[model samples]
Target: MHEVFTSAMLAASVAAAPAQLSSIDELAGTWTLVAADLIKTDGSVVRDYGNAPKGLLVIDSGGRYSLQIFKAERVHFASADKGAGTDAEFRSAVLGSSTHCGQMRLDGGQLHFHIEGASFPNWEGTVQKRNFEFTGEQLRYLVPARSDGTVPVSVWRRLAGQAARP
Candidate 1:
């Protein structure tokens, strides 16, 4: 009876071990732009937004993603410079363009994000995704460049349990 109990306990522990491991489900949700620091190849940090740049990242269980980034200062410029142009026009010209697309899973932990009509031509290529880590309420993922040349790395954080609109 003692041996049987010990075996059952061991089996239960083993079964629960996989659950402890992190999975992509942890990343499924909407993420607000907490902070984005673009690191240049020369190790220079460019703080374009000065603390808060409006941005959002949405990850779905069906393997889809959409991202938007904007600058608060641009709204003022757009209104002044665009000549009655809508806020969208000002945002596009100033903060750059937003990216939308579906992601394909390369493996259990890696994903290939194909940007749909990315504003930046260089980013239009396939993005290799990896290195996912979660701390507290934040989930981060790394996007490496497909080419050997310099590429920007993106770090994303969860958006307080809000569902991704797109």
Candidate 2:
């Protein structure tokens, strides 16, 4: 179940929460996507990547962000050109990837992802809300539901210095 932050809860949290988290700067850094699991209603977890998923969530000082998450065993396009991949290859690539670019906002630890565009066209121009948690160098968020009615909980780790493009 999701935690709802009431006024009293917000007040209590603000007292102990660091000031940086009150602003976007708290999220301004390179964060490696550690997990994205589809939580089935049955309580079983379905993961996109068989092993550790490959992903990157980068936030600039301006609060603008870009994210790319992919499965580990993706096959390279035999055609070598992005647009020229075979039909099966295209299906595998598309189904195994999630990408988006936009801006981020936080309200009492809740994160709002303002999508300018996304690989999944349905999400383009949409604003999705998620509950966020910060623990040490980790940031976690829960996306209510994906198209399949499965919840996706994303975990990210704060990376020191510039990380390779994901």
Candidate 3:
């Protein structure tokens, strides 16, 4: 019963999405993160990654991909050695960045991630779906709503001269 309902919901979402790229090859290339925001139920926006978030996304023609996002102002560890960081520094580091990678599938306007690994261990070995749209060189996607009802949205811009795979 649960599976049936889930399938129905998935079908509905796909049907409701706007026109999508004709082929996944259209999404192949490198993208730079432009904005990361959390929209509250009351319609206020919060910058989850500060004013200047840094991120890179690379997707290959074979459907393999890697992604990393960082807070521009994340505090550097006081110690030179990465293995030697204070608890505070470690916590700050972990909380300020997001990284994950794996195979991807684009179905309609949905971007599905078969997460093989992530900075947040809970996401490893999980499959997540996001709704996305493209505008010129930019792509925007909405993350599933969090338990607190805030939705995270990410925007990315394709780099110059990155050709799409046929």
Candidate 4:
């Protein structure tokens, strides 16, 4: 009787343990930037995505993320090895283009990102975090200001059937 009771108790405990956090595998795929809203310090709204500026975000199953931003009449520089110019000149001439590689993980319902790259030199040692809320077809991510500044919000729509394979 004692042996049976112990076995049952252990089984119940195992079953009661909370499920592991969902991996980035669930979010892996190419995601197009649909729209963005920026809240200014004075509480004004800015709809700047529909202009010349555009953005793209790609998340891989291996917890890597890449982001690209493009704008009209922007002269961006490439690495000298790519035949653009010297490394120093390339870095100085790069105006608004940015490429960042980062690790991402999902905890509960929040998505966390750790950024790394020379593209955004200021963000080299920083970890940018965001909270994600999902609806039927849209996922809204809210990013709070690191300091006491205004916050930025992004809304992404999933491409049909592009979720990572199980």
Please name the candidate that would achieve the greatest lDDT relative to the true structure. 3
The top-ranked prediction according to TM-score is: 3
**Clashing residue pairs, backbone N/CA/C < 3 A, model 3:** none
lDDT for each residue of candidate 1 in 62-159, tens digit (9 for 90 to 100): 66777776654453443464578786775556555345555634455444576654656666755646544445355434445335433333445665
**RMSD to truth, every model:** 13.1, 7.4, 8.2, 15.1
TM-score of each: 0.57, 0.79, 0.85, 0.62
User: What ranges in model 2 sit over 4 Å off?
Assistant: 1-20, 161-166
Q: How many pairs of residues collide in each model?
A: 2, 0, 0, 0
Candidate 3 lDDT score relative to the true structure: 0.77
Off by over 4 Å in 3: 1-17, 164-166
Error of 1 at 149 (Å): 7.0
lDDT of 2 by residue, 1-166 (tens): 1222333343333334443366776677788877766666554666745466789998987789999999877878888689888988988888888999999887655678899989999899999887666764777666766567666667788887743222
* Candidate lDDT values, in order: 0.51, 0.72, 0.77, 0.57
lDDT of 4 by residue, 64-132 (tens): 887765433454445546575766655544654545678877765567778876476887757776666
Query: lDDT score of model 1?
Result: 0.51
CA shift at 55, candidate 2, in angstroms?
0.9
The reply for model 1, stretches above 4 Å from the true place, is 1-22, 42-44, 48-50, 75-95, 104-109, 145-153, 161-166
The stretch of ten residues in a row with the least summed lDDT in candidate 2 is 1-10
